[model samples]
Target: MNAATMRAVQVVRAGAPFAVTQLPVPEPGPGAVRIKVHACGVCGGENLARLGLLGVQLPRVPGHEIAGTVDAAGPGVTVWKPGDRVGVGWHGGSCFVCDSCRTGDFVNCADRRIVGLHYDGGYAEYVVAPQDALARIPAALSFEEAGPLMCAGITTFNALRNCGARPGDTVAVQGVGGLGHLAVQFADRMGFRTVAVNRGRDKEAIARQLGADEYIDSTEDKSPGEVLGRLGGAAAVISTVGSSPAQADIVQGLSPNGRLVVIATDHEPIPLGPELLVFGRRVVAGWYSGHAKDSEEAMAFAALKGVRPMVETRPLEDAEAAFQNLGAARFRTVLTL
Candidate 1:
């Protein structure tokens, strides 16, 4: 195609197939930067645009785990310039005057913009994003490695770091999938006694290789909570799966005053009892993907600690197939342009 036009995969309607169309290369508005997208990870979060959840408009490019270099910067944008490597995650931008932003919680801003949902995202050759939404990718990370780190990496890393579990605490990572796999590594590097809980023994070897100190098979007659209780209970459980029953079942595994941090998204309500929380002062909290600074920190930590996500790369043209098999991917799937 010409320089002015670029290939983009867009969801034309709710639950419709992704349409590969030629669109004019978007120019950066004031305080924005246009990126030459090198890689974008296909995440379940794309369902927001694919299914039109959260009232997303039609004909929207769906991708938030973006990694690339700045091609151009708009007027009034000084922090980022052309050729600087950067990545953008779910938190696109926030209204600076909002109460949440004023309190330094941009992720919870009254008017928080989400990448891919608010505008065209990195499911294309070019994506324009707000200046403040850019996260500097460390030199050690490739575009493919940095893409998933923007969302999956940040969500797991940020949540584990802020989950109030101290070093040496028993931290169990539920589901050794996309987020769980990374969470296992982060938990180990963070000095926690990491536990990997999954369906069977099939992933035990890999989990241990990823630094999990222990493995619990959920399919066994003994529940995950019971297994953890035998090991002195877990200081925290990071639930990376969207199964509500599984989340509730793991609650009994928490030590007194233990916390359960849920990062996976599901509409079903967790059937938790008052007794469970009242007896041990346990807490069930949810963590959203972090802001730009958080993403940078997560990437830096991953680079320093030699933590990386196992990803399968596909050509940009295969975005539909990649997204369709997202859940079945070994861990993460990235679309390379």
Candidate 2:
């Protein structure tokens, strides 16, 4: 198979709709591999792209949570062989000579490329990526089931796990949306007492059903912060809500030494009263998607705990529509080739 030609979804302009066009498949460069994409998950990042919020260069594919198989390999790409199942996430490729890469902190690399944003992504029949960003998917995992973890999964997993979550800690996930729902499950399975904090009576049932031991309805009775305070305050607040308004309401709920892990949106400044941080000793931190350390661990944990996203699949041609659906607060959407 020459595999010289393949199809992909291209974003030609920001703020306008995306189009599915057939483009020549990119050959893997040195330390890279070409993958035949079986599935790619739509993400909040695409939502940002569609709205021009991310401000990425126009006309780019917009998917990072990718799952597929290696069809070809570039020179020096020895970790993967042809036909091997694999995945690529948001941290598409990094400059190895950078200080961050030298320190094994590829996520903070000065010259990092993001799939779909910085380069063409997996929203197609085939995509190519640096071997360092690739993780071998488990044999038992299906492409659809494993796709979301590449971005969404690894993001939440890294945020919490790296933040020092321990068994039996009170982990409150404010906003039971896409990331919140997954965080609840991850925390529950990881032995934390999970709390789902949302602003309505609507999410209570579903939140608990998704393994949240506690639900705080911010819309009624008390604000989520007050509710969290009543529960003795959270040991850690993993905020999946992107908006500052949402985060502003819950920031005060963190206990002394507790952390607020915010990852939903960029440029949304989270405001905290200086006294609160000084008195309560709470910390507010933001996390990007993932590095190899966390992504690799996330896959192993997903396989170990059966933590797959509650995904809705759309055809590759419908990627733009899928982006709309995802933006409308629709849960998980995976684009299948």
Candidate 3:
């Protein structure tokens, strides 16, 4: 591919694998910035696009966790210029005129455009993004590391920090996968008494090393929630697992007035009994990837606290394999350009 065109892996249709193809390099429209993508993280939900579950347009590039440098700027793009290091996440861009945006709650903007879903994303050598969607990448964080932080890191970090849990309070992070790993680190370093909850002993050591004060392996025929309660009820339980059972397994374990913050995107209905909520005053809520400024704060905090995701790198040509190995792999996948 020349400077005029770039290589990208596009999903031609639902249930089909990504096809490596060449396309003309996209130009930034008004208020946009073109990034020379250095790295893009492969998220589990990207598979939804392959399955046509995300309602994305066909023959599209799918990726939301992106990190790179700006190479060009569009008209009226004053905040960012060429050579600026940046990353973009799921909350791509919001309509500034929307009520949510007007109130500075861009995360809930009714007209939000989801990257890789509403528009082309950084699953290519180059991707153009709206200026407002870009998060400044910290120099201390590598492009590969910053890539996942845009989505996985920001989602986990942003949720935990804002979930009403205080330092020294017990916080349980369910699942030891992509999002949970970062959640564990943030909870630990942020001064919370961290508990890592997951099935199997394989990730126990890793979780503890990542700052978990306690590791709960749920395979021993004990409810993770009950176990958490036994160790002094958790003030907050962040469910990062995609399984419905895994999420249900922790609802009853929260401390009185405890909050359950869910960051996973599982479509299955979460079983919630009214009794559990009324009896303990427990509440459950879901948080999506935050706005670009929120992502910037997350990146800075991760850098300052030395919290980083366990990541595995793959060549862009191995995009299909990387996407296939998402959940089972010990570390999140990052595609290097």
Give the TM-score of each candidate: 0.98, 0.94, 0.97
Q: How accurate is candidate 3 locally (lDDT)?
A: 0.89
**What is the lDDT, from 0 to 100, of the residue 217 in candidate 2?**
84
Residue 95, model 3: Cα distance from true site in angstroms: 0.5
lDDT of 3 by residue, 113-232 (tens): 888888888889999989999999999999999999999999998899888899999999998888889999999989999999988999998899999999888997568888888999
Over 17-55, each residue of candidate 2 has an lDDT whose tens digit, in order, gives 888787777887888898999999988676555555555
Candidate 1 residue pairs in clash (backbone atoms < 3 Å): none
Residue by residue across 66-159, what tens digits does model 1's lDDT show?
9999999999998997889999999999899989899999999999999999988999999999999999999999999999999999999999
Give the alpha-carbon lDDT of every model: 0.94, 0.81, 0.89
The best candidate in terms of TM-score: 1
The weakest ten consecutive residues by lDDT in model 2 span: 46-55
Candidate closest to the true structure, highest lDDT:
1
List the candidate numbers ranked by TM-score, top first.
1, 3, 2
lDDT assessment of candidate 2: 0.81
The parts of candidate 3 lying over 4 Å away from their true place are: none
lDDT (C-alpha) at residue 300 in model 2? 83
